[model samples]
Target: MRRTAAALGATIMLSACAWSNAGLPASADETTEDARDSDVILNMFQWSWTSVAEECGSTIGPAGFGYVQVSPPQEEIQGTEWWTSYQPVSYQIEGKMGTREEFAEMVQKCDEAGVGVIADAVINHTTGADTGAGTGTAGSSYALDDFPGIYGPEHFNDCREDISDYTDRDNVQNCRLSSLQDLATGSEEVQDTLAAYMNDLLDMGVEGFRIDAAKHMPAEDLAAIKSKLSDPDVYWVQEVIGAAGEPIQPSEYTGTGDVHEFDYGRQLKSAFGGSIAGLDSIAEGKLDSEDAGVFVDNHDTERNGETLNYKDGDTYTLANDFMLAYDYGRPSVYTGYTFEDFDAGAPGSTATEVGDASCGAEEWTCTQRLPEIQGMVAFHNAVAGTEVTDWWDDGDNNIAFGRGEKGFAALNNTEGEVTNTYRSSLPAGTYCNMAAGTDCTETVTVAEDGSFEAVVPAKGAVAIDVEHME
Candidate 1:
């Protein structure tokens, strides 16, 4: 789903699967409902179950993140490579992430903190590597196409070679991706097997899923699998990488749930990398803001340098601040361990047993814990359903906007400080600058006419919501 190239080929198969009542409703109702509770999600990339549990109880829950997207928990190939999680070996809820007991405990603790856990479900395929046969992390052994109790050669796609023609929908869906084994999703037996695994997670109290490589499976086939799930109301966000003129469009998968808006991230990178003024044109883009799950960057893009990340310093924080301020898609912030090699797994052991995550540790990059980003999460939740009103810009690097009367934000992306008097939507009063933190040295006083003058620091931002009013 990350890399791309191909040509058209003969179509291989199609399904007559009917729509499922178990899937989420095809309306903005879910979006509106979710915003009312917690609008922001945190993708805690590659964190161990123990680490996730501790953070959920101590930080993530109190910070008001609606959900945490954890790494794939299924048993997978034993290796230190990060992509090993994508190459699942069995449905057992045990892998480098943690054991089944630890995973259940994490889910329970997160739920207690009012945070839902979104498991990264890797059901599209099994181990595709020709690394011979071996036992997985959970002690499940397998040969090339022979996963003992879970699957056999019959459950895999007939097209047993690497995908050569992305332009061909058949080749893209049925053929192996990057030499990984492709599953026969159209098979009812496979659907039942996948549903059993997902339902097991649901039984463990998981609220939703981030379906990995969803575009590799036919829409109808996915629908068939979803129809068998026990939980009818769980949330979903599909990883469908659709670009202009691509054979697979994100919209095709919307029937199941919201699609990860890769285009939105690209646009944010372009705007933040150049001038803040370019953001004014973002509203006119092709993506429907309501049904999109937006983010500044994800685990994949951050490593590939296609999007801005924590390493970009204040510029990265500013971009996320802008995202939270704007009433676009449902925003998500990412946190992960630091790495030099793109494919390197989490720091510590040989990637067999993940180490405990600690903010003070040299390997962790907890971007979500940054004061500015944390403040913006509250700003996003506080201004839900409010319209983007009173937009103002300097025709260059500075821009300020208000979310009706609920909140206001001014960003100075320029190299030098910017002092500007802008119309505000907030009530007249003294307010602490949330972006600066609770012990902030800066304060803004709005007059009865809803106007305030602010001196925003270069590469820094100031955000104030009704909740932060003094």
Candidate 2:
């Protein structure tokens, strides 16, 4: 039997169905687990099924990641562009990523490694009406609103035009997005088909789903579809990019599952670009930490330049390090191929088939596998359930803080090493500096007085946890 742990869980159910990006409000007498109590997620975007299985056993599982969010596995359009995977033709678990049998085996391998798989479920719409007739990665034929043995024009929406008005709920929810045939999600036939497709993946041992383009579909319709799942309580996170003054927002769907907190990344981008001191209030105006799935940069944001990405080099590393150390929403580290063009495909891949992840290859930037990043994962797991305390920042580029008595971290984003005596909540002991790479050669000592003096290197970070001592 497969062992599964959810990276997404909503303890509070909303009383009012209001559409606000603000998260679930806790009751006066309500008590909930610390937002950071859950484990971290590694979004291995575009990684093949076989490659993901190998990575789970080799790196991800050992690093203590609770889950790995994979790209869409259903049969998708046959194109070299990465977005092609987002355009589905059928519900079969056969595509460039792998065959149905291979996907099952990958799930088993990851389960054995204690890593749960969260599949990217692209159920909002199918092949774009403009793509004409073509074959999918698994040889399924699709054209316009026609998917043989799956869906047809009757299953799609009557709103044939593209979405333009955001404030208008009807237009935003019903209209076609980029000419992709929108599913009649409210209809019984479409809902059943979508549920069956998701149930298929769940039966194969996927612990959750990252509902793609969730904002395009009405929250009520999505909730209905989720109710029909084999395990309605299965972990899921919706990709609802929060936009100001938008009628449909992330909060509207928290009753169903967690929603990605876009503000978290945007704030990280701004703070890293300016001063780390500004990050003190990172969660002030966003979703409550527990109901949010936060990331430094995902596939879309990396291309659209909405947040700091792997290209930002040291800055990106420092930002992610801060995210891991901070007590906030569940964190997910993203890794993928390096590309200069927006529509470029993954490395070692083609229009017909996808490639596997090779860590050291110049084309693939396995950011999650970096020594510093991997060490931070251990630091994150060690400090789980702790609160941020002893916060201190230089008003400019340097900051240091502790997570209760479990861990301490200091980061310097400036060009020169910054030395400072920072207060800590950790007990008196020498601990390994987490950001010191794989060897963990550097150590920091927390004195009986609960204070530590250290020199944080420029454009770098240093972290120490009780579980990882020198």
Candidate 3:
């Protein structure tokens, strides 16, 4: 580990210092209790100004999602294109998404609903376009060759013609991403400017940030900007996608916050399709142990045809059911309106002037509001502290497991009907059949032998507990 810099407190800029978690004593029982008590899973996949503000307070607020991940709130070059949001014109909060006041209202509303707001910080670069829309950016005008007094030519690396290899650490960290304008994060001026923009959002009651293009920035520099901000709860979940064996590792950002777990999506895709045994695989430690952020899909992967997002009907529900039933690193649910093209903006899409209600104009509800969805949420909350106790799998498609004594879940992916007998950890009583979708409620009566026989559908899953049992 690198020695702690003496000038760490001197300026708010990043210093080349490494954080070591070695010999940091284990957490106490009470501390774990407090952590479990306060932590709340969120579904903040949508990112427009009005949609974010309204959903932050109302839509996902009451669902007990602890955080709201808003879209990039910074001003971008004016264009009808959706990717324009990713191409930042300036650090200013005003954009087509919504105005500064609307952003504040969203944050306060989420806070009031016991949820935190996370801003998407795009400090990695600027608008890569040459002309026709680059104007009035953070009170400065910009051109292809002459970006006014605010940004200097030295602040940008002229790697336009000479593209650097992303496999190399320096090139990935220092060079431009996909011909986008690369900002010189190592420069003192750039650090201060970016830090001020982030701090402004923090002052508006935003809790943390999702550092976009985090893999393209150095950890030391990110730490420097993080040190400048004065919020104890300022969480950072960087977007560093990783597979089974990748050079660009997720462990690099474990000290910062949680890294996005791309493997989780792969696991869900495989397990739900019956390629991998559901409960047994999860029980036998197929999933990574370290706390990597888990999600079915996100904005980029969903659009790129890489991972399975929740735009579909029953397929999405099965995926989410497994996620809620099994324990994984901090879980995040995605809520979005159906889109015809990948580059399209969010539903009920409106510019910053119209406000959040516009998003609802295109809002479409699928399995997210299903009765089983609510049941899974309650089950996840109920078995928060427990670990997988009794595991059972037929080795092919049928599987079942219990989360200590709190709850039990089973899955059947076989073609025809198959009965499975498993130990019912819950006390003798009638339990609710969660997967039956309210049309038919099957009763699971726990026998004195401490076991229950569940006859599931031709191909389906089931979750039962003492509370909602008929």
Candidate 4:
């Protein structure tokens, strides 16, 4: 299975579902096992460019996540608003977060610690709402019909400004989204510029890209630009929001890289909220397989309330734990600081320096860094390449299951604790419990009968491993 940095969402359930051309490789090869190792791909999302390196050190960095999904790295338009990063001034790596050199240093340091970096590439459009003569550090000019010749008007969709016509493929695919200036990606100049920008990052050591607003761009044009990138190791993940079924959908981008599986997040949250049944049901497993990327919340949907966010409270933890426990899409964990309004950015009111500038040590939820959270990473790594087997559930929200023979976990979100005995697949021994707070405050023991008794707390989850067992 190829590791990806893709979009996942809730609103996507409203659209028709689509499937990926490729599936998990039939047999687990060395590459498959390595990729499946949660210790390698356990990821966290960071706002500023250097936040990953500054906050998460080699300790959690190497043992858990291999990389980070950083906020957009390109030059963004200046505004008091936080959405400015969505508005690209140019393709230059320089931005409010950091300069090109600083970004290079950050990526190198993270790489030294055995963690990779995935940049959020926002190439769907340009800075101005229309377009105007503005120069990026790389000397790229912006021209639009609203302005003139800075970036030619022909570069735009030149159709209706408002794109309410979802039926019109051109308006949906080519036209500007959210009043952002649409770039004619098919143009040779534009393709070369994008390639140049990406190549710069490749030279600086970025391993992959999360193509922003991918659903809005012409797949062929995006493909051509991707083809020009220098690194074949550079993975591509397009943000094709909503369901798949349009003439231009996620499938178009799959041959190049994985597209976001938006429906998974919605279903996950619904399941955790008790609106849907637990994971063991064949119905629920089938529901999660529609796409490759699985996540509880992302930058956009977190603001929209259509998806689960940190502010949603403990509910997010339950859903996230379930996602890790169950086999599904490549999980993208959201790691951010506290926020008040829907439109908040990082931990700061203004976009200034990178690293610890935006959010302080107090606010950041370095998700994978937490012991309970890191336990999930360890569980995933221990059970790498194992299919979930020996599924057991009472059908009343309390459940227990094992992944192959490597690990077993249980969850009880009910009002009272659960003291049930079930087959633990794992060897007889004691293992540390993750959901029981830091330093493995709780423990689980498996007997020679392979039956373990777990007293699951109300509204909590527990995980145990064979290796950790005595």
Clash numbers, per candidate: 2, 0, 5, 6
| Model 2 lDDT tens row, 1-470 | 21111100010111112111111223111223421122678899889999999998998888777778998987788888999999987777778787778899998898788788889999889988888898877676778877776777899989999988988988988898898889999998788778777776777778778899999898999999888876777678899988998778899988888899988998899998988886778889888777888999999999999999989998999999998889888788998989999999888677767888899788888887888888898898788778888888888988888888899999999989988888888889888998866466888887999888888888998899898876
Q: Which stretches of candidate 2 lie over 4 Å from their true place?
A: 1-38
Each model's TM-score, in the order given? Answer: 0.92, 0.91, 0.81, 0.84
Q: What is the lDDT of candidate 4?
A: 0.63
Sort by lDDT, best first: what order? 2, 1, 4, 3
Winner on lDDT between 3 and 4 is 4
lDDT of each: 0.80, 0.81, 0.62, 0.63
| Model 1 Cα lDDT, one tens digit per residue, 1-470 | 11110100010012322222222223322443233257678999889999999999898887777788999988788888888888887777777888889999998898788788889999899986577687777666777888876678899999988888778899999998888888999999888888877877877777778889999999998889888877545678888988666699888987877788888888888888888876766767645776788889999999888788878878988988898888887788999888889889887746466777789986899877788877777777788778788888888889988989988999998888888898987789987787775455678888999898888989988877787776
Q: Superposing every Cα of model 3 onto the true structure, what RMSD results?
A: 7.0
Maximum-lDDT candidate? 2
Task: Give stretches of model 1 more than 4 Å off.
Answer: 1-36, 438-441
lDDT of 3 by residue, 300-388 (tens): 87778666766645566667767777766666666555666877665544432222434435554433446666566666666665677
Clashing pairs in 1: 128-180, 128-181
RMSD of each: 6.7, 7.1, 7.0, 8.1
Give per-residue CA lDDT, model 4, range 376-468, as digits (tens): 766665676667777778876777778878888787767677888879778878788756543667888888878888888776678887655
Model 2 TM-score is 0.91
lDDT of 2: 0.81
